[model samples]
Target chain A: MSLPLIKRERIFAAVLIIPCILFITVFAFYPIGYSFYLSLHRIILSLPEIGQPFVGLENYRALLHDKVAMHSLINTFLFVFISTFFELLFGLVIALVINRQFKGRGFVRAAVLIPWAIPTVVSSQMWRFIFNDKYGLFNFILFGTDVSSYKAWLAEPVFAFLAIIITDVWKTSCFAALLILAGLQTIPDELYEAARIDGASAWQQFRKITLPLLKPALLVALLFRTMDAFRVFDLVFVMTQGGPADSTNVLQFYGYKKIFTEGLMGYGSTISVLVFLISFAVAMLYIRFIGTKLFKETA
Target chain B: MNRLAFYIVTTLVIFFSLLPFLWFVDTSLKTEIEVTAIPPVLLPSGTLHFYRSSIENYNLLHYVKNSIIVAGSVTVITISISIFTGYAVARLRLKYKGLIMGALLMVSMFPQISIAGPVWRILQSLGWLNSYQGLILPYVTLTLPLGVWIMASFFKELPSELEDSAKIDGCSHTQTLFKIMVPLAAPGVFTAAILVFIYAWNEFFFALLIMTQQEFQTLPVGIALFQGQYTLPWGEIAAASTVATIPLVLLVLLFQRRIVRGLSAGAIKG
Candidate 1:
């Protein structure tokens, strides 16, 4: 059916997409390639006298031994795992709640988007103020004695980590909720009605009907949020500056700090490459597992 | 039992979602002294001084104007490009459609942090640093892929008979797209514009990295800088934050239904 215009169509199609191809090549592929090139050479901005020198794989070796890099990798994974998990869990619950026919549902839905719509930097700063040691609302709420002292949330490692997590969960869970709500709406109510006719409990109906039906949407939401959470930088950077002792330094911030603060451009590029690889691997895994399964099932 | 449990849970969820904003508003209305009182006044002592002072001193209007210009220009450029590109990809029966679509999706998912260094260098070389053009150009890249993908899906879902009839009347391809198909796809285009505008408005990292001058900063960056400079000024910070968020909140409220439907449709396909 497609054979008659194969040659002409191919040429036309190639022409149509030339600009996009060029864009991706220069903006996407070039940067990725150049990052690797930059990583091969040591360039320290502070010492102009030292200039640029080819260091082979020494940058990678140094990264392997670098405590800060190792810490950040672990912290990054921890953040991705923890935040994505909670966001999905709470988002699902919220979606299920709002998906039901109820009074004021429209208002609830609109109100829910308030947190998600606020810019990350603005929300991060707001939460930072809320978590302030002395005059902040957090301390005011937990108003208590010495051991439970009013510690500057961003000035303490554990507290800063918790503060970042809380702020992130608050800000982004709405996004997760919104996505999952979309998924929930796709499950026909007739499925639940039929399940109820069979004497299934609400929980059972949800488990069998809603869960199975929501799998694809859930996976899409998970993949999006996971990728986003893994690359989180602005919120943590604004709120804590990866604080007290670099406890909250995720991979992005770690890389930014290296390049900008320390002027270790080559080292930063190496970290950036690792972050790219990790996220790329995760994306591939998601496509292989969830994407394939969802398509196969839908088909 | 289920009804009662649902009501209780719903109330708790609403409270959780609203408490932050409520606290923000409450703080914004209070004087600095009232804000930092020992037990922290939840409600103001009938004062609007903080908000009044914040508006007068912070140059909130300037930041608002900067955000509008950057975000507005980004939306216009993104929508313009995606309109043609999306229509061609969707209707032209173009070969390599799958590859093109996949590349678009991949670009949307690619992390910006990785490209920040090179983007910074490119913008510097072009002498676009600290300029609206620098911000808008990269923002176009940020918004273009998603806009194209979503608008393409929208265009694909639209019936082609209208375009066919217009073409039979001897309209050029560009005219068919612009005059006929575009009117039909206005809703999707508007949805795409809203998403792009919001994304551009809310973006912080690139804005901070590229536009270093105080005057060039957008709302998000401006607010962050405000917090840094006035670390102890919680009431004022809250006032500024509240001011920064009001426009988007109002927009979301006004377009709540369309936004939700658009999000669902866009996500389902893309």
Candidate 2:
């Protein structure tokens, strides 16, 4: 190949990758940069004629004192951490069950994915009905003995929080199972056979062999689920709309309400920027700290 | 695990996972009276009235049509762009593979909330709001990372010698990709298509924000905001939900293995 051919090859490579980079830059990175710009100005859409004036850090300052904003951030963190834990637990259980040789295992695996595959908005609606005061299934299952015993699952603060958590675990735990199952399949059968030959109990074998090897999958699952759970907008938007005194007001939903309903564009953008920062920080932490080490060990 | 124990756990897992959907399906089949019954009608009533009304009266097909258009465009565009980019990153000795991959991953994790405000404004200013291009542009971008990861994994696994032979034959990079690589990467394309289709079909955030007009609403937004004030319209909602889920269920059943492979491909490798 001539020098011209080499130059053409490099150009071809650059051309190949440009569309992907360009689309993301415009639609992804540009919006982010624009949001940051809007965040620094008081640009309320409802009062647009007032003009967007530069108000450095005022939105962030207000966030510090706004109890609702504080509450939403705390709620978001709790939702992410708690749901991730349950998702990991349930995912492991299903992974273990599916890993073993069983009749109709494939069917079960596909069935479990149905929940995860269903649109979150639709699934959240289903759960809303399931948690409804009058005709809810969970109400019947729990307090069916007496009609008076039915507690409005989505009405009260504590039960509403539990409802959101339960809905999340139901929806996402299968994703955890899928990732963990992939990990489980990669484990050499000989390790389990050797452990069995060594008279290791089931629990012992799991602890000594499966757990360590499953760490990479578990970490990946955690990374995906935690980020996803933190941005729980559709679920809350459908099921509760961050209502009943804003008990379930997650950061994303709160930002959404401000931007859309109240038309506080700049303040809402500020909230969104914070969400971006928090999730970005988490991604960096995963890549720099856990992602590197895990990939190295797995490699 | 023992046989009995396995059976028990599997049953529980299935029950826990599927009960919500089953309940939704049941409600979709019921009368309006049965839907709001105090104790709830546990058994599915054998009727298609709600389905009929949902489609005919509520114009559910219009939304479904909108969904197909937006999601189809998004999938085609995302797949086309990702194929070349994935090839470059995985095969063409891109000098900044780590940086490119990392940036794509970060884009994947980019918070939709963070961009919601500016995205809306941009679309509005472009006069693209309530238009198909508006939704497709962002959906394609937001979903690019996933498609790239899916394609790149498949590209990485293909033997390098094949590319060398193509190069030896004086085939240009695009020619090689079109004539040689695409045929081999059909399975990856199929997998990426399925995953991206599911996402674009179900995405509510941008769908709600961008496609404000009723004619352009997707299935998720249409069903979510289906009923107006004073009435819940649970049956119509359920019917719409069930109809929306059918294609996904069929896809899962037919391509169960591919779905799993596509989902956990790169993540599991780590």
Candidate 3:
């Protein structure tokens, strides 16, 4: 009770931090460990009589040869790569447009954020309705009075996949733009003035100055978008439900189907574990590229 | 680009961003006949018929109430816990501060599915499934990283001399935090609360898996699973969607600056 003030303060700090650590350890870290352990066992929810039995690496081996799992993995990658590409492209354009001082810039920025602020479920449903065959905005604009030419866009494999990507890009491009805008704000006007004095055109100045300076923000946006795209479940669950012949199925949805719908608990854990490892690996790579100095700055 | 071209492109970007949601809003106001026209109607008659039906028949209020309870509880609890943690890391002389912050960054990056299975089992063992506490506990844990990071940044910005003078004046660590630092960090607390509330309200994956009962489901889950005997109820779904999104839209319009600052803080600082 009579300890030095420094020791007392340190003890108090430890007490303050313990609760936060406890919540994460119990809920987040524990669950990840449990998921890994479950992946090594064989448990079927419906058939409890079989009991849980550890079969080391068997589920992992099975996942290696599982055709549907393989297909969904491919779909997940395709979704991540394509959607983030468009997200970055569109995000850059929006950031550049709204970056400048203009009339009603706040209004325009708020308008741009509306799609992002709306829940993924609501936006997914909106897109679903928009691509409706008989009476949808997409068809109404395309076919107009030519009712015979209207098609059920979501029923086709290619279009359904495309629709989900389009929905994601629309919703998240604003988020990417916001990050890029933060980066744009950091660039000095003096650099542009110097470039102009040296006779650099607008495009030349952009290429030489803006693009190079924007790399870190662009990478951060890409990292966030990539991770989110891999975890896409609400869109698939709401729109297509893994769909016209499982074409729209992604990794998380497939895992949900395996565990929740099909009751293959152990197998589903394997899929989820794979997801965690992939995300962890990608995050590591991005962190390295962005450098640990970023964390140091925040810390 | 020319002035005219700049204006055109700016207008086009905003229009493209808002069109889908506006179209849904338009559909929500349409008469039943206008909703399903072969060539869809360009304009609505401005009816509230679907909203009435959605409230009465769809039990939209129940889902809204559930969402409010869960999201509100998460925001309050997360912000409270994070205040202490943030002060400890940002103000007090704590060893391993860098490690704790790095660990939190990793937790924030974790995929939900990675933890979904085991967390479900843990809840079931405690027999808390399909309850508000069941959902709120996980949400608090998930949102804590965001809350802590934002709060820490805000706390770090405050002058250390203020806290030191309070300590020299015989104030306890707790008093100095609650009386001095907490008020200064209120904006960060507010930002974190809004973000956490939006996350809990919009979350569908956990809500769908955990809250299977109709009475316990949130708005996103309820709307996602909206059904009818013969066909999908597009009008009612649109009505429910419009209602669910209005608060968030209003939030964006009002606190757009805070929202942007909160979102970009973690990314750009790094």
Candidate 4:
């Protein structure tokens, strides 16, 4: 009777998970498999004349030589690498500042979420307005002239890229701070107090106690931000549309243009595969970190 | 002086985070003249010019309704699925526990663009293009993993002894879940619901991709496509965006702790 009861519970658990697994499979897993399948064929939705053909690695080979894809790939990596580094640095300062007890701390924490809470489309558009050459806020702040002497921030490659980076840092640094702040909170206060009792300076305390304990959280924040940043699209789409000769085009946006705009399904799938590979590489890095740490801790 | 430095840093953080939206809000209130005027209007022009016109001339409210319907359905469906699956994972003695979590995490990392072609094809096959269900299905899939992660963490935190007591008191497993566990995990549910709702509301890519019909277009999609041939009515857009974001900002302010806790748990644990 006891064995049956346990078996019944196990059956219930299996039944409960079926719906969740089914939805995920239909919408998530199936699409990934189908996308890969699509990537191998020369399927152009726009050109029925071409017909679908088995292309195998041709799309992948083309992607290697394609200038736009290569540029976008490089741009995606550069953007993620640079922006993530700065975001981490800025977020660390922010987390440290807010981690202390202070008046209006709650307000500060709440207000800090405003940028992150605003939708990516909205924030990107807002930044676009702010970076508008003629009558924008950035121009007003930097120029303050009645004459037309402001730089077209979104029209030039470097400036446009910089504009995107600034908007991204603004939108995401709060997310970084929130994650880091959560990590900081997990560091027991007594450790800092103990270090203080030993006459450790504030810097010394942070270096010895906070940094070591905060490693996991810091890694999580870095991992999350870097992955999302590499797949940057909406911001680029709404703001620059990967403009100024595709200088600002990241891989995701490049793929969107191919699939949606150009209607090159197979080529687009290749770009998507490229994006997937980059993201997979990042995930692999995170996994290796986790694998080593797990081994060490359990050992 | 140390406290002074702290306050200064605090104020800077708040100011930087809040100023972009504040600048847009200021633009929203100004007349078209002030909005375009050089040496740009630093303050509100005390006119509800764009707000009034955008609501009257443009169907701003229509997009809001579409967003509400789509996002609301998504939250209901996703939270329902997530709670059940989360409960299963948290309580059941299941093999392949690591595999399930790993699969979900790996699935989450698949670039949305990577799935764009297949998802579009599937929607086309189902004849769900430009429909509410078209957007909600994919939205649920994208948001479900985080939901499950949050709820499962919360469920794992509760003492199993409570479940045992409920069992002895003549509660069926389902009844125990509803009467005892759901109430305790209500915070997790609420957190997950708020997050899923926000995600569904603010998602632009899939919304833009799937909802082509004006009537079906959500807020982000509608506002994004709200430009004229030669001119963009920045004032009108700013007004609409502010109106849309106000409720979200308020929700975040009111339940900042829950949002933070839910997000950190999903992310840090992953």
Tell me, by lDDT, which candidate is best: 3
Interface RMSD of 4: 3.1
TM-score of each: 0.92, 0.96, 0.98, 0.96
Q: State the lDDT of candidate 1 residue by residue for B213-238, as single tens digits.
A: 87888988877777436445677678
Q: Chain B vs. true chain B: TM-score for each candidate? A: 0.93, 0.96, 0.97, 0.96
Runs of candidate 2 exceeding 4 Å displacement: A1-5, A293-299
Candidate ranking under DockQ, highest first, comes to 3, 2, 4, 1
lDDT of 2 by residue, B100-162 (tens): 777778888887998999989989999999999999999999989889988988987898788
- Candidate 4's docking class is medium
Better of 1 and 4 by TM-score: 4
Q: Give the TM-score of candidate 1.
A: 0.92
Ten consecutive residues with minimal summed lDDT in candidate 4 chain A?
Answer: A290-299
Interface root mean square deviation per prediction = 3.5, 2.4, 1.3, 3.1
Could you tell me the lDDT of residue B206 within candidate 3? Answer: 89
Better of 1 and 2 by lDDT: 2
What docking grade applies to model 1? acceptable
Write the residue-wise lDDT of candidate 1 on A1-299 in tens digits: 35554455445545655655666667676777777777888988789688789999999999999998999899999888988899999888877776788888878877887888788887887788788777677887776433256767788898788788888888878778888888777777888888888999988998888888788788888888888888788878788888678899899998888887798878888987888888888988887767544232211
TM-score of chain A of 2: 0.94
